[model samples]
Target chain A: MIRHIVLFTWTDDATDEQKATVTAELRKLPDAIPELRSYTVGPDAGINQGNHAYGVVADFDSADDYLVYRDHPLHQAVIAEHIKPILAARAAVQIEV
Target chain B: MIRHIVLFTWTDDATDEQKATVTAELRKLPDAIPELRSYTVGPDAGINQGNHAYGVVADFDSADDYLVYRDHPLHQAVIAEHIKPILAARAAVQIEV
Candidate 1:
């Protein structure tokens, strides 16, 4: 399995409404994309002050399968519409397991 | 369950031997710390240049349980003896699932 992890730090001015929208949109992804094996997304619980504000971890069968989900039109739409506008910093790492 | 995710970027001066040692040391934690329900750690596959150099995703039964692992003597030893010296940047996120 390919463990694809992404961390996001929201823009300083981003509103609660916008963050909620991003969460809802991301929750819709697994159902919309067949390439995903498993997916989890959530906000930081504030245990670590140095942590990112939000993160997602999704598993795919392989790197190629992950790429399919990454480039899917629905995923692109969400990035361009919901995520890009409010995003501050983004980081990711993919590991084979 | 609480999903605890941590991303790390090693210092520029860190050697390959140091990176390998960090990986080996971290892989020993699951058996050493009872609070860790599951753990996975690996190098960043370089798919994304903007991504950090490595990451770890660990699962725990609760926030308090995760803290137990975080502050465990064995974990602290690994961090202080291996990780902290080589780490350039670190970010983390913990969420309830």
Candidate 2:
């Protein structure tokens, strides 16, 4: 299995509504993308309150499937429309398991 | 459930043996710590070749359980004895799911 993990820190001034909109849009991705085998997204519980405020973990059968998910128009649309505006920093790790 | 996600980048000069030792030590945590409901650790497949070289995803019943795992002597020992020397950077997100 290939796992793609992304951690995001929202821009300081981004409203709760914007964050909610981004979260809801991300939550819809698994249903829209056939290559995404599983998806999980949530906000940090803030024990440390580090830079990352939210995270998304998704699984794919192979790296190719992951690439497909990454390049999918719907995924791109979400990034361009919802993510970029409020995203402060993003970090990701992709690995086979 | 609370999920603790950590990403690590090994020091450029760190040896393969050191990285392997760290991975093995982390893989043993679930058995050593009863509070660890699940544990997954592995190196990055390097599709993006981003800063993080390895990732760990571990789950617990609650945030308190996660704290126990974090503060456990075994974990602290591992960080001090095995992780800190070869670690370059670390990023994490903890959230209730």
Relative to the true structure, how large is the alpha-carbon lDDT of every model?
Answer: 0.91, 0.87
Residues A1-97 of candidate 2 have per-residue lDDT tens digits of 9988888888989999998888899888888898999887888888985548888888899999999999999999999999999999877899788
- Tens digit of per-residue lDDT, candidate 1, span B13-74: 99999999998999999988888898989998776668889989999999999999989999
**Deviation in angstroms for A79 in model 1?**
0.9
Measured by DockQ, the strongest candidate is 1
Q: Top model by TM-score, which number?
A: 1
Where does candidate 1 chain A have its weakest 10-residue lDDT segment?
A88-97
- Write down the TM-score of every candidate: 0.97, 0.94
Scored by lDDT, the top model is: 1
RMSD of 1: 1.0
Each model's TM-score for chain A is 0.97, 0.95
Model 2 chain B is weakest, by summed lDDT over 10 consecutive residues, at: B49-58
lDDT of 2 by residue, B1-97 (tens): 9988888888889999999898899877888899999887888888985547888888899999999998999898889998899988878899778
Model 1 chain B scores worst on lDDT over the 10 consecutive residues at B44-53
